[model samples]
Target: MVVFDRADDTLRHLARYWGTFRQMGDPKRSPAIAALEAVLYEGRAARIHVIYDGPTTVGGRLIPGAREQFSTGILARASAGTWQRLAPKADPAPKSSPLPGRVHVVQDGDTHPAQAVLMTDAEVADWLTATAAGET
Candidate 1:
């Protein structure tokens, strides 16, 4: 959280934007990629919390195939698993813990409620606990 002109003030603009490029192009130096890169640049006081919860590919390219675009070491896979047993309407609990992989971003707050997302590796639980009670 970079403080912009916060010398005597604590108020600052919070930028929580998400990007998705589902077209074909040079992702390495693409405009959208550059914009994200700039936002996360060092000494910029801008903290971009990147969450790969959207399309798996950028510019219509697969993640494993887009080597050049993700050359900045910003990509990594996580370990996630799902429950094979069904939940009981009789209030039965499961035995194993859920995996983590899902990502939820509260961009608009209570103004727009985020859609339901099924992620693994405990990602779902984390997101659910993040913004409790309301959605914008």
Candidate 2:
């Protein structure tokens, strides 16, 4: 299970590996493969999780109840009875003055909340994706 301090980072990593699962061609019989696509296209700003078992050709399968947590805007999957439990660590910084209609951009790998930036949603997403891909 991998946890990201920022949602965008999670999405970027997921998108990069999405193609690997698409070749499988079916989700119902392959929950793990299907889940990857589902999360990449439908996931939102919430905790995102993914699970992968060995290739179905190798006799692996996704487990049930793998998508139960953070369902409203999160994604999860499991295979071979194993699931990745990726979750963000809670930020520990003290809150600052409340800004009306402001969006907070949390830093990826930020162990403390104080390091996060106050930016637009798009900026946050871009930062996450770029960071996940090992870009500056």
TM-score of each: 0.23, 0.20
Q: Stretches of candidate 2 above 4 Å error?
A: 1-3, 28-136
- lDDT score at residue 67, model 1, on the 0-100 scale: 26
Error of 2 at 132 (Å): 31
TM-score of 1: 0.23
Worst 10 residues of 2 by lDDT: 74-83
lDDT of 2 by residue, 1-136 (tens): 3333443444344444654565655433444345654563445434455333222112222223333333222212322132122223323332443544332222342322223246888998999899999999
Instruction: Give the distance in Å from residue 98's predicted Cα in candidate 2 to where it truly belongs.
Output: 9.4
lDDT of 1 at 7: 15
> Model 1 over residues 16-127: C-alpha lDDT tens digits?
1212433555343345434434543432243443333232233333323322222122111212221111111212222322434322222212111123445775876676
Question: What does the lDDT come to for candidate 1?
Answer: 0.30
Local error of candidate 2 at residue 28 (angstroms)? 10
